[model samples]
Target: MSTHVPFNALRPGVDAADVRAAIDRVIASGWFVLGPEVEAFEAEFAAASQVPYAVGVGTGTDAITLILRALDIGPGDEVITPPLSAAYSALAVMMAGARPVFADIDPARLTLDPHATEAAITSRTKAILPVHLYGQAADMRAFEGIAARHNLALIEDAAQAQLATFDGRAVGSIGIAGATSFYPTKNLGALGDGGAVITRDAQLAARIKRLRNGGQTSRYHHQEAGANSRLDELQAAILRARLPYLADWTKRRRAIAGRYRSASVPPSLSVPREFDAGHVYHLFPVLTSCREAFQAHCLVQGVETLIHYPVPIPRQPALAATNPAMCPVGDRVCAEIVSLPMYPALSDDQVSTVMGAFSSFVPPTR
Candidate 1:
């Protein structure tokens, strides 16, 4: 019988007992929304980020939107973001009533190129939203310098980067405000949809808190226009349960990435770029010349793979009115990229099995 390796192997290494225990405790408390569990998770998360405060929200989208809104970024303002990223990054800007200006990424690191960011700046530019794509930092120190000179808000989209660093500094803690997701598949995922905004600014944190909770600092007092986006108690408890393991989980992912880098393989299939610092490897994406053929082969061999994003945000039907242009590198990378199975509990045998399938296809000459 042939063994099958599923695409992500969702929520692997989770102890059912741990989840049950957290659930039981939450049920007993009867405080569901923005209660003890949420508070505890926020505190724990803030500490993890090396920041002063973190506010849990409904989703990563809301986390970015709320932080932008709190910073008073609105219709007349423009926010610079990467051209190649999850649509949510640009969508968050629109949701905040701001214009999202796209800057091309550094092809090697797959992150916002600082020079492109500087060039994209205009009179209307109010913030720079640099996404830490694929569990690696987007040169925050460089962005910080640019933002400081331009007096722009430095917002970080660290959805994929949990405990990943640049020059040994945390992504979330470096920016003015950083947003993260706890979607089912994230390195620090919750049971369901959840997210958080982290910042060192006490006042900004307070403003974001109000913006997420119907614009009220107190109960039933509508202070400003806001939206309903709170992290549920159950999700918070689950996140708290997983919090302790995040660092170790990241280390394991790095080890797996190292394995892939050192392994002898076909040169036709491009591996991820080498980095000087740590990368959590949320998805160990590989680039292939014949992606469709590769995917077909993997499927026939009882292995599953997925594309992180097939279409760029600009090409989406919803953004058609926006007239977003074609990004050549972004389009090329999207067409060629495929994520392999990666998770904390993934076994060495599984890794070998997956790699063995690719070994059949030899490297083609230039």
Candidate 2:
């Protein structure tokens, strides 16, 4: 048994030559860093997201951090967020100098529970950052109503969701501001690290632009102390080159997900949900109490499995130092979750092989 069916193989698509061509063109032009490539990517991304403006930045983390900074949310401010996601969500809040107040998730969807979110709000609450975990839109309609009542800023953590939508509205454009990652594993990934901020509000957009480029509207005239987090021109060009084919790749991902659902999954395993057409299936995570054992089984069966995250942000040494009681739900889910192979290039044969591995194991009837 060969390990060809590994966890995730990079599927750069047949059009990567175009990405290389775009990169070569940029190199030939001498102008690099935040230049035309970045400008064009920003404009194209805004159009794709149906937003007024889009700001490309250094990384997914910077996308979130810069958005919070632009909103002036720091120090005494507290942001409500889901407890069942990458600690990066919490890290972004801490980096912005705010407290990350965690809300429990809807176990079925593995996204923020709107009721829990509203209950968690306090006087210090300035924003609600709901992660569109596993490429499915969070219940934004519920969150929006709550945000309106409290006058809180709604920032979407859309790192996993590129084409994902909410009621026909694109994920990044739904909230006040949305942050997305172009990490190699995302639905619409870039060759290397990259990210963007999308928003409909022009004022918020202007601030994010300044935040990404050191708060200087003009050349070298600094206003506020901002972090250096601009999206690289080369990466932007690569992303732009790939953007044209996003729809096709996304459709393939959905098709693969359908196969997984129709096929035989482990009886004890809980599959991810299909919410409208918005779910992009970034990482098809499954819930299992015996995650360690399941991973071991996959290893023996020549399939690779990974935990999206094993530790919640609050429990991490760095985060625990500040807030010991950050998020209990996030902590528990991180312990029990496992991400299966879920890229567009994953073949039907590979799906069958993984399913066979699951069928081979069965728990004793208790």
Candidate 3:
């Protein structure tokens, strides 16, 4: 059997010596939690993001939840977001004591549709949260307009859009607050789990910092209750190693997507239409009515494929009583989406083999 192409190809882009040096430096310092590595990484990440502030946190989920808590968004507040995103997006809202209102996604982009977002708003709505799904920017322009009109905060879920842009500005910099994940597979991934919040507002930055460190003003001096969600020194150092290559990796992802588009795609399958949307192509999702059968076909061809999301949040049993609003587009897309291998480390031959599998696929007969 041929080796299966992986969805993510991690190469440890930094030299082994460099990684060892960083580890040695951190160990020698003996100050791990909320230490210099984390501080320096935050500053570097902020500079790379073109934002004035960056607060490192334990995970992407905590990043979003912390931003919500710092913004004082809780209790009866309702946050409007697309149901097509990771469950963590909705969970963050719930974690902050807010209700997550479901909204439809743009069928073409598979991201939060700004018009649908506005339509889903109620008097209880306090913010508009948009996820930059699949490494392509959401319609931030429209979302910004709607948020301004409604006097709601605009929080961007940039977990997959580390170096992605929207209308000439970095996605994270445009929103009042934004969150990102540095999971091992992200374009600029860390060696382990990590996340951050970016903002231009100084006050919000300070609040997020304090919140991440147990709400302490100084050693055991609790100003207010907060969670222990600080990003650790080891992971921060690893991410710092990867930050410089973000652009190159994103370029590789885009190149792969371009080849996939130009390949012989069967009429039964659909590729995303974001060639000009500054898409980083974190996952190259193809849509087919027979997703399961198509996956089996890929497996038989010695290629591995995965689903970006197999279920829509509105349909989640835990959310049954939130009386989740219907998102027909998101629901339909969820059933049909399949993610092909996507990552910067894929070689040209690997990409060709994956495309060849798609070109030769036959639809399952009903």
Candidate 4:
């Protein structure tokens, strides 16, 4: 009988007891929103991210939008972003009332190409938003130079990359501000929906905190029109319980990815090169021209596979009015990419099963 390999397992295994304890503690406190648990999680997350401040929000999308709102980037402004990421990255810009300009991705790194981003910038461009796709860091060094030259904010969409570093520097801290999600599938995920903004700017952090809470500097005081997007205490507590185990989980993910990398694959499939050693291996995706057949083959072997994205963000029907520009590289990548099982919960037998499945695949000749 062939061994079955799941794409990911969300049920808490090693941290089950701690997770239960956290939920009980939150229930006992009877403080459900913007309370001590959220406050403490913010500080702890800030330290982990190597940033001075972190503001918890209702979701990752809100975190990105709030960061833009705090920077006063909206309405007539334009933000350059990669087309290959989850549509939420661009939708977050739209939520801020700013238009998101689609930029091509670096074919090798599969990230927002610095050159393409710089080219996309116009006089109205207020920011360059880059998604750290598949847990790999974008070219932050080049992006820093581009932002410096254009006087634009460099915001990192680090939803897939938690505790990932770029050249010894932490990802979220390298940019003006970084946004992350804890949507159960993430590396440092919470029990439910959660997100945060990390930054070194104290004023920006404070502004985001106020902005996330219905624009209130104090109770019943609406200084400006702000969205209600505070990270609740229960989710914060859950995240806190899971946070300490993140480093080890990241290491396990990296080890699994390394095994995948070292495994012999057929000529039809190729793995993307690891651009940085600090990658936390959020999702292990391999490229193949024969996506449908490859997926079928894996499924037969009881190995579940998924596509990271099948369409470029700009191509989504929701963004049709943005007059979205064509991203040739992104379109090609979307057609070819597929994600294999990559989670810390995967056992040694599961890993070997996945490896054997990949090794045995032989693409049908045209």
Displacement of the residue 127 alpha carbon in candidate 4, Å: 0.3
Each prediction's TM-score versus the true structure: 0.96, 0.95, 0.97, 0.99
Candidate with more favorable, higher TM-score: 2 or 4: 4
lDDT of 1 by residue, 128-237 (tens): 99999888888888899999999999999999987877888878888888999999999998889999999999999999888888998688999999999999999999
**Candidate 1, which segments miss by more than 4 Å at Cα?**
362-366
Ranking by lDDT: 4, 3, 1, 2
Sort order, TM-score high to low: 4, 3, 1, 2
Which residue runs of candidate 3 sit more than 4 Å off their true CA positions?
A: 1-3, 11-17, 275-277
lDDT of 4 by residue, 97-206 (tens): 99999999999999999999988989999999999999999999999999999999999999999999999899899989999999999999988899999999999999
Better of 1 and 2 by TM-score: 1
Question: In terms of lDDT, which candidate is stronger, 1 or 3?
Answer: 3
Report the Cα lDDT for residue 64, model 1. Answer: 97
Q: Compose the digit string of candidate 2's lDDT tens values, residues 1-366.
A: 644578877656577689889889889988879999999999998888788798999889999999999989999999988767777887999999999887888777788989889989999999999999988999999989999999999999999999899888899887799998898888778878999999999998888888888888789998888889988998898889988888898998888877777766667777766766778888888777778788887778877888877876566787665663555666667888988788888788888777776656554444
Better of 2 and 3 by TM-score: 3
Question: Across residues 12-131, which tens digit of lDDT does each residue of candidate 3 receive?
Answer: 744456666777788888888988899899999999999989999988989999999999999999999888988999889988989999999999988998888988889999999999
Q: lDDT: which candidate is best?
A: 4
Cα RMSDs of all predictions?
1.9, 1.8, 1.4, 0.6
